[model samples]
Target: MWYEILPSAGIILTFMTIPGFAMYGLNKLVLGNGYRRNMDLRFNRMMYQRDMRLTGDPYKQNGLNAVDG
Candidate 1:
């Protein structure tokens, strides 16, 4: 009876552990990619805003003159 229970217990433990590890790995992968994508989006948006500021004529018409002013 003890020997039979040992096999069943091992199977149960294996099933539980394997899925837990798989889910952890998948979670890490998704989060890392999402972070990278977000950073890229932020960078692109900043660049676009900078370009718009540099090329726009409103500041010239308003006589702001300086890029930082």
Candidate 2:
């Protein structure tokens, strides 16, 4: 019983760790510093100020749409 359970547990752990490490590597390659900052902003882990550089209709933050306003 112990032998069967241990192998199954090890295989499950391997599957889980592989993807976690892969995603960590991908995020390191792609996102660099921005990911942490984005996560922090999302979770309210840090305070942020508006960049105020954008110029457009303030209410139209989303992409272009066909709906009549």
Give the top-scoring candidate (lDDT): 1
How does candidate 1 fare on TM-score? 0.40
Q: Residue 19 lDDT in model 1?
A: 73
lDDT of 2 at 40: 48
Off by over 4 Å in 2: 33-35, 38-69
User: What lDDT tens digits, residue by residue, belong to model 1 across residues 1-69?
Assistant: 568799889999999899767766775686542122223587776755565587652212233454554
List model 2 lDDT by residue over 1-69, tens digit each. Answer: 568799889999999889767876786687552233343454343222222123222222344352335
Clashes of 1: 0
